[model samples]
Target: MNLKAWQSLVFQENQQLNCMIEDILINSSNMFIGDQPLRARKIYHDKQCEIGEARLMEDYFVDNSTYDDAIYRRRYQMRRSLFRCIVDVVIANNDYFQQRPDAIGSQSLSPLQKCTGVMRVLAYGTSIDAIDEYLRMSGYTTRDALMNLVDGVILCFGQAPQVSYIVNGRENNRAYYLTYYIYPSWTTFFKLITFPTKKIYKLFAQCQESCRKDVERAFGVLQDRFAFIRHPCPVWDKDNIGRIMIACIILHNMIVKNELDAYLHYYNPTEFLNNMPTNRQPESYTEDDGQPSTFSTEFELEI
Candidate 1:
């Protein structure tokens, strides 16, 4: 509405209005460019942005050998092998993110450090500030690291298109096959199973139920491994949510690939079955009372 302010907004054919506005803003006596009073300061010298070089995040967590295996695993939620694999892939794929020119020419966060920070946040379900102190990065830097890391991971490992299969059974029904189905109770179990004799069928039903619990336990393990998924997503972006989920699953797959052999070695099914006793000892609730443990089958039913 002011006449003098209105006179300055002359639109050019090239439409450089924003640049003109920026020039007008900083040339108002405060910003000094040597003897030239109107010239604005360079971007590198701008007081607003913290784009200069800082401490490396990997220096404390990854390079330092002070942390034990347990501490490292607990913090990162993966073995060193798995983390290294992730870091390698991210470095290979996220080529656009390069160190910028700064005071020391910006050694910014290394690819490993940025990816590690993202993985730690996803694993711990902590606020960005939680990692700021140890990581030596501001909250915004950590946030940017997470966004970029997830983008690269999702792009690198998103599910590929496979040959589609649908067993219609000639009824033209759209249905997907579930990995497993569950029977909620004994009544529902009897309804679904055609085996008439309860005495013979009970053991089979119990075994199926145990397998269902095992499936549920896998999901529980995933939630425990990456607590970010268990918590409500704070970001409103749908694409970002998808990226985060895909990245987490990709990381989980890497962990499985790296650690599955160790798991199989430790819990060899054949060896466990060979050593299994016919009669298992009853668990105790208290040492002296002789009461059944809450972990016992009968006590679990009562609860």
Candidate 2:
């Protein structure tokens, strides 16, 4: 290219780069820069006053309105009492959430609203944007609320006897709890160990599969009932996501408890077993008699 043309092109590119740099610096400065300490302190005081004024609005939002009714349960997938219990526990640890505290801003979100927002994120599996209108919360605020609320709840409910089983693993817990008992049988051990084969292995496998199927069916119902946990979580933070997942499980347990009293009487295993025909004793055999030679009598597995 001609020297003159090259110089012109270079000049234009330099101007464009300068403009871009100016734009970036301006945007970055706006994001990070703020009022000085004195001004900020005054602003903080003003916010505290606003938050204090907003306190009076809380009386209008009684916990009994939707809380005392079935509609609240349907929407949040948790009973009012259980949710209130969460809010109460969370408030005790983090007084910033309470309706009235020894601190500043009157406009801050209440514990109830925070709890509701967190549940909405889990129950609907939606973005923070979804709750803005109903709860009148900004996406930024709601997102922060959700993350903190999950942490707070995990602090409160993470170690409860029921939720303690989360570490024992979900599927294993389901098997232990719902299955009530899993007998020590060859089929149960076959899949869990490295061992020899037997003619009865297929029968044992079938029995194991049947037991697993029962577990699967129960899990399927749980997942289908609570769609929030069934699908891939949209949350970015692994810790927050784990907490939310655990919170949903705790809520699920509470819901199950509410419904259990209605149908628990129908679950009469003793009656059902009594109706089944008794098994016949095997013909007398020695301790070393014609047991399956392929079976490893020494094999004993525990999970």
Candidate 3:
């Protein structure tokens, strides 16, 4: 339907709302990921509800017209209403969302949800309170309840391996021998080694670093764009506060992914390229005193 028609329909359906949601969807579609534009349109259309459903919703609203009730009903409908069809579409494309738990009730979440929540918390540095608020705002009841849900999500997500060096000599292995090293104790000696497997481990390290940088850049952008976070959020309910924070994190990730994709598409490279070089290369030595340097006294170390 044309924008004008949609606007009129929205007005006729709910006069209290001066503007149509279609405009929000249409205008914001460009800011979204692939196929999101169409999905937004679908959400706008499907969420409108049939006459009978609208009448039922109106009756519910009339019966319970408090602000809290309105908020609850709005959120509930957003999750379960026909308007949520677009959300389903978006979540279907995102394995993270698809794998996340539905509700933080008595039931435990699957392994994937646990891992994803843990990773998200770690990556975002989001406070437990913030997570709780997010869940509550999204329809969860209690902070402890939400924490249990997050625990399950984190368990499902699992812990990523911690990369460290070990001494194992092989052609592909790079080993360093420390004859003596001190760490607040008598001299200790050990051999440290690392192997570049050219496999998932290597890729994971690269992706981990990339994800960290992306999260940092995203927060920077968010802080720049929305100055509110720079100041304290006065909202007292910890659960509500957490929900807002999580929502911001989700939005930030969405924006970052969109920008990254656009950048890749603009470059049209056959392979994905890191924003900065990942390979370690030796720096060329130069004499600062205008004298020829014959010996190199410094070496690069990987932590």
Using lDDT as the measure, the top candidate is: 1
lDDT digits (tens) for residues 135-171 of candidate 3: 2211122233334433333343334345455547524
Flag clash pairs in model 2: 48-105, 51-105, 51-106, 51-107, 52-106
Can you tell me which runs of candidate 3 are displaced by over 4 Å? 1-142, 164-263, 270-303
Worst lDDT run of 10 residues, candidate 1, spans: 45-54
Residue pairs with backbone atoms closer than 3 Å in model 1 (clashes):
none
Off by over 4 Å in 2: 1-68, 99-105, 160-196, 199-204, 265-303
For candidate 3, the 10 contiguous residues with the lowest summed lDDT are 133-142
> What is each predicted model's overall lDDT from 0 to 1?
0.64, 0.62, 0.41
* CA lDDT, candidate 3, residue 102: 38
- In candidate 1, position 231 carries an lDDT of 89
Write one digit per residue (lDDT tens) for candidate 2, span 1-303: 999999999999999999999888787755445632435343322234334234423422365342344766777776667777777888889765766544542456566666676677777777777866556556776787777776786677666664224544544333132131343554224352223288576655556668778868876866765666777876777887677777666666667877776566655555444553233223444356666434222333445
Q: Give the better candidate number (2 or 3) by lDDT.
A: 2
Candidate ranking under lDDT, highest first, comes to 1, 2, 3
Question: Clashes per prediction?
Answer: 0, 5, 17
Instruction: Look at candidate 3 and tell me the lDDT of residue 91.
Output: 42
- Evaluate residue 4 in candidate 1 and report its C-alpha lDDT on the 0 to 100 scale: 65
lDDT of 1 by residue, 239-285 (tens): 88878877887777777777777676544475445554334454556
